[model samples]
Target chain A: MTAVVPPAPPARLCPSLAAVYRAQLSRARGARIPLLFVATFQSIGIMVLMRGVVDGGDGDEARAVVAGSAVLVVAFVALNLLAQYFGQLRATGGLDHYATLPVPAAAVALGTAAAYASFTVPGVVVTAVCGALLYQLPMGGLWVLLAVVPLAGAALAGLGAALGLLAPRPELATLCGQLGMSAALLLGVLPEARLPEPVRWLRDLLPSTYGVDALATALEPGPDWGSVAADLAVCAGVGVAALALATWAYRRAALR
Target chain B: MASSIARPWPGLAAPEHTPDGTASAPAAFTVRGLTKTYPARRLKRSRTAAEPAAPASDRITLDVARGEIFGLLGPNGAGKTTLVKQLTGLLRPDSGAITLLGHDLVRHPRRAARLLAYLGQESTALDELTVALAAETTARLRGLDAGAARRERDAVIEELGLGPIASRPLKRLSGGERRLACVAAALTGSRPVLVLDEPTAGMDPVARRAVWAAVDRRRALDGTTVVLVTHNVIEAETVLDRVAVLDAGRVIACDTPDGLKALVGTEVRLDLVWRGEPPLAVREIAALRHLAAVAGRRWTLRLPPDRARAVVAAVTQGPAFAALDDFTLATPSLEDVYLALGGRGEGLVRS
Candidate 1:
């Protein structure tokens, strides 16, 4: 006689990260229209201001121009953080509603991180193109440029998610974002030579520092793969660790 | 004479049993010794300071049967939502067991997730998404294919009478419509168990009826078990097969609607409007044993299940009772049952 086994229970259904990514993309696209308009006009204005100063410069002058544009990119990123976090706080409801879904806390955190990353795409592209046009730097490695930009944006987005999770309320999140942006801009974008040793060391620890460094290396006449790889690794590590913390914090809050 | 006839039904043959040998039919869900305690701050006013904190949500247990619409009746701060959260896996219990479809809740939450759908008190749908999109998203989250997701969304929309406004963004919908959209999202996958917390709040009579009809259809067509947390006793009377009345995080009473009403031991008041003054013989006829009290132009009779018909016959046939202008009988309703089970004052406010 043969024995019959009962069938296994049906598998649980969980939404894929791609679906969460898509939902975030749709939301970001809606919120980015005005931000894009402002970034376009701002990029054009910066390009016009830089055209005369570069004046078909030599390699040394070109290096200086690229460095200056990196500073501009860092500043632009800071502005992006300010606008994105404040707008999200004012426009969307708090994350309390998402906690009720059967989705894991990590998925919710990843969704918001992906949304912030998507919002940065237009600004980063415009800044890169404007920097190349104004400084007459090499732009042949388009694929590499694409890869580096997203990694940097992911790092920044993860930091934003961590901040959003830690802040007591939406208003507090906006305030903290503004303060952090101010500190980063002060240390990194201001003339580096004038900063003291301790301040310079602190700036190096910021994720924005690595992002600005990678952008400069990407636009240089000769590609610096070593520096690029180092920056990308550091940024990626920060992003993963911060995102993991945010996920854990969110889970603790929801479960409590 | 009537009292003698009312004492034999309990001795009759019992109902047939199932193959499993349990006295009652097997229930779809059974919970034992469930407990959830949340740390809450204790606020105290003194000369200098406030006190610290304490634990809430003491131990509680419940059982629900197949196709039974059970109400978890409670007032504010009664831990009804906390229990619902634990049952849906949003929060873990401090201790105890919950078995649904024979699967342990804590050890096998993922398996339990497939069979249960929870509609939380908040309308959790995205405001920017259209009603159809919201329903389709939830269906997809429940792992339905694209085609199946659309079909299920359409079916739920139609069932909830949301077809007319299906394409409208959730932000544009009225409060009731928004609540219905949330319910539609929860119901799209057609899971076998539904945990609804005040689903009918903010709904008009028409919308409320539509929600009840959808629940009825789900139960009848699929034998789905529904656990409803509602305070609307009037509407609940028509739909609930049984109820668990809760007070201060405790289950005060759990029973079939008829059984709970029986616990109240309420009597039917027969108001006999006799013309002028009636004869003393009629008063004597109303004074039968087991009848609690007889007053002016009214006889309050405690009619047990067996004595109801005989009592009515004797009152109508007695000669002195011939001058009656009108007579009416009032039995215990669900509201009375609710009040009898210690749910009174502010607790009786219908949702």
Candidate 2:
């Protein structure tokens, strides 16, 4: 007869970062995939509508439209969704689960942001490819989009997380996320020459605009890698700072 | 009656010592001068504005011995949840020190976290994940490897009889099912100390028994220390090695279940059924506090232990002795002690 045995002892501390990232990724697999598809389809639809209006535009105009449309996908999946997710989590008392765990607050915040941002990659790539094809722009430096998606996602997702954490109600959080996405749309999709000087400065302030600038520059026929690198650097710096702020917000929300 | 206390309470004096006079086991948790205050959200306008707001948890202190199942009993809004949250490191205390498993909770909360598993009163966290995933994920987060997490999850699911809804999302389950799933997640981990807050609140009898059985298994097998915060004091009394009664943010009393029960020493209850023609002498017995004489057939009475013999003789010594049926003499229970100390018994309050 076989004797029953107790299971082996498990680790006392929270799992490693890879485990947390894996868990978050798996959790978002079902909920995020459909949202990514919607984002991709929305960006492609915008490009199709703008095609007739920008049919006989300069290369700069074409680059702006394509880059703006592509980055909009990142705004939708990374910024908008992440803000709403964290807001709902806080409102519903879901943060207590992580707070009680042995994991660091940074892991919970960073892992969630990274997972949500990662989902935007597919939509960003699809929109970039489709937008360039429709606008008749050069795709020579399009490989630069690989860096643009995550860096921009980090910047936007971080803001969304902070907004969500600070919002008193989940509904308010959703509104903030929508406003952020709309700002991305208005500032990012339009060619810079069409905007007034003041509004152009506002566009420069938007984090996604830097992402748009990088991707748009990469699409130029004689792309200046130096300028693109600078734009990407700004995006990276903003992403890191925004994520740090989001993590701080997470700690504050937990205390509350 | 005044000398009935077996020993000076741990709060009034040092903790009760074992026969060897050495402290039994190392304390699983030690809380001292733990105080937390929040701004009075519903302050009465008539009060003097200069008065300080009341603390949510007053200067509370206690020690829970290792391998002991300790029950934390209190009424609603008695700072029970607040205190447990502080113990689990989810809430910070305004002023105090907490040491859990020998690690200072405030200074090294991560280290303390590794030693404790908490089941909160609410189950919102489980709603997003499937029952199996929720249990498995919590197990993983507690430091279980992939294979061990799955094994523990499966074991807990089977123990809790959650197989039917194991694959379903927690949001879709009934409230009791969700509670059972939460219990499964909490108990599946091997953390040395477990704090469960109102775990049986929504469970059915079968599920409640399952939860208690699992906790009992953990205690018996690994000598795991458990801190159970519960409203179901009657059920909790069966397994509790020691209990602390909290009222208005302070620990009023802490003792073994028997010790608590013994506070109202030998207070017996007599239940009787009367037939037709209720005897005047039995009905007029001064010591008997009559319950209900339904249809002149059933009757229950509560009285002091010293009056029991006199009342029993009064009923049986008369012609109505044969009329009495289903007579039962009962000793006092934990509920009696709870009502006498933690609740409305104002005279039993300790400083």
Candidate 3:
């Protein structure tokens, strides 16, 4: 009995990172519009409320309110939404679907993080524009935001993904995401001068706070370029570190 | 056991033959002493109740010959899924070795990834993506290029009759449609080996037949190896070259369907559809020692091969023979083999 051998498909190699990224991006197509709207309007409302309190205040206070509101956009979608997505994916056996594929675990984790981070861009841009107008801050150095959104989004999104993977239940993961977003709001949206000495350490630890500081420094008249670059560098470093940690966490959850 | 097919399953296209040699074909998978243990979990409602850690698969050893459709038959919690997961490299085995093609599955898992296309028990990854895109993306992930992936996606979708809902989101599709989409995605990329877990779980008879036909077509056309894990024993029997019946984490029987059926004995089953109660003379036949009720209208009498002539003579002479609408005598089927080997006769049964 002869075993007939059919013509084989063209041999291809490992999973393409770009393909995985595209697939992951497509997953959010349905929620993209509503999510972006929520992130934008929510950040704008926070800015509007902060604007009233900082009315007729010094430029430093104005910079804090505007920068904080802008970074809040990243917090809303990247941190909050991403956590819930991963949490649901885990609880629903979605990881098994990816695990059976030829794709590397890191690609799955990073692709998801990149997709969630990309979703934050429109919100971040809109919030930055509205916050600057509300605070009457100069938009001269607004170009710095081009670097700020992704870096802050990556850092927050990675953390959110990690939390979702590590949590034992989906509900707990959602709670962790909400708590993380709340921390971002309290630390990122408030001026550092008003924070206590001990609580200031937490502000330093919150990745989005550096994003706010960077944007605020850039808005200053005759801004300190060195400080802005330093803050941006820290944001970039944290983004890389958080993403690596998230990839590690993904491997842990999937293999477990 | 190594012989040409006298006749392939219905609807299967004949395979092209190469006559150089057929006796020395390779084995697709060689798994030896594989085992997996899940940690014990404390009972949620009663903390005092603690269950011991159990081995899901205990020292499983099997060989799947190349170009064969092999079935892994078992009921729920029978360790079929765990064993398949280990074979496909999704879960690490606690011990022993799995050699796929030539590479060690535990040591060189990347090789298995290239050769095996797996359909998981659940379709959760691409639930939000359109069915067509899901199929195409999975093909892409399996290393098919853009054009090839699209072609494969289209061909598989058409073959499985998924054209009507190809553009619909998987979440919007019916359970059977979603299952067909998952099967289509799994069959893409022209991999040498396919591992499907419960591919026909929620499918109707038509869909189930379509899936079986597709699997048979693959084996006939490409000499591709298939490892089918399912509880649909009767339908699975039609295509299975060989099967391993697993129960409580162990393989209790392994053989071709006919060979397994022969294990019970050379018994011809006499089925009669009667309009009234059986005659006293018919029940007095010695072969009726183990008479079984099939349905309201039918009754079965299992007779040993040697006693067939006497039983036939006795039944034809009985007064109840006039009330019988129809009667058939046949060898035992795979369902009988399943029942004689401890399978629960609760689901689909064939007479």
Better model by DockQ: candidate 2 vs candidate 3? 3
Residue A122 miss distance in model 3 (angstroms): 1.4
Model 3 misplacement above 4 A: A1-15, A56-58, B1-25, B42-51, B266-333, B344-351
Report how far off residue B172 is in candidate 1 (Å).
Answer: 3.2
lDDT string for model 3 (B1-351, tens) is 424233342323443322333223455677778888887787778957676777889888887766778888877778899999888887888898887765578885545667788888778778888899999988887778889889999999999988999988898888988998999999988777899988887788878878888987887776678898977767666878888887767777888887898887887777877777655455554346457656776777677866766666666755766666778888887666766788653453341
Model 1: runs farther than 4 Å from truth?
A1-15, A29-106, A130-145, A166-176, A221-225, B1-23, B42-56, B107-111, B265-336, B344-347
Q: List the residue pairs that clash in candidate 3.
A: none
- Residue pairs with clashing backbones, model 2: none
Candidate with maximal TM-score: 3
User: How would you class the docking of model 3?
Assistant: acceptable
lDDT of 1 by residue, B1-351 (tens): 011112222212322333344215334567777877665444566455444333234567666655667788766767788788777666677788776655676675544556677887765336656788878876766656678878998899988889899988776789888888888887877776789988887888888888888988877776677899887777666678778877666777887767877887855445555665554566555455334344565545545545665556765776755766566666775556655677643465544
Superposed model 2: Cα runs more than 4 Å off: A1-15, A33-45, A48-52, A56-59, A133-141, A166-172, B1-23, B42-52, B265-335, B342-351
Candidate 1 lDDT at A122 equals 64
lDDT of 3 by residue, A1-256 (tens): 2233232332333345566678778766774678788878988898888767786323888888888888887887788887887888888877877666666777778878888888887777788788778777788888998889889888998899998888889998899999988898888888899999988998999989888999999888778989999999999999999998888988887754
Error of 3 at B289 (Å): 13
